[model samples]
Target: MTTIKASCPSCGDVELTPHQVRLVVCSVKSWSYYAFICTTCHEEVRKPAGRDVVALLISGGVVAEPWNVPAEVLEEHEGPTLNYDDVLDFALWLEQADLLAAAAAAQGPRPRAQAPETAA
Candidate 1:
């Protein structure tokens, strides 16, 4: 029966119950957020929730949802970004490539192909 006060962009202030609010706690702290529909405007409002805000919302009877993000997704990479053409080329190559043979080859060491002799 707790009344939570929130603000709407169009309507200044509105009240909500704990059940009306959603709190998501992400593995990446900065990505944690809370969302709720504005009681006045009926629009959904989402805002980043820091540690303090998270704790407060929980104490106010809102249940916190856990979000586990993969570590690989957070990894930083340095390289040229792939474009549509690059993807198309890879797709075309894959269509002609022997995937089963490739997988079998990957299981063991294969002899390196010798380069053809070139005239000096």
Candidate 2:
């Protein structure tokens, strides 16, 4: 198997095979990132991949995964801009409600069924 050399923050220089590195390409901003599991420290490492680096990784046979921004996030919003005050207000309000319980509440209560017609 082909080996690719990469630097691990904790372990300095390390060699990883093509199968060890995974490439993540972001379509939104033409950005790419490399993710790998460091062998020496057994830690997950991720770093931005520039154009030249991306080409090198691709040449090494690493799998490339493309990602794009969600459609909902692209939609325009007209809401007021949030500020520190808003965050403080929310924090205060959150304390009043059982936030966790409310979030865990079931979908909603079903409407009561209508009584069958009774002939007098």
Best by TM-score: 1
Q: What is the Cα-based lDDT of residue 60 in candidate 1?
A: 98
Candidate 2 has what TM-score?
A: 0.60
Candidate 1: give the clashing pairs. none
Model 1, 9-42: lDDT tens digits are 7888889999999999999999999999998888
Against the hidden true structure, what lDDT does model 1 obtain? 0.93
TM-score of each: 0.75, 0.60
Model 2: which residue pairs collide? Answer: none
Q: How much does candidate 1 score in TM-score?
A: 0.75
Candidate 2 stretches with Cα past 4 Å from truth are 71-120
Q: Which ten residues in a row have the lowest lDDT in candidate 1?
A: 95-104
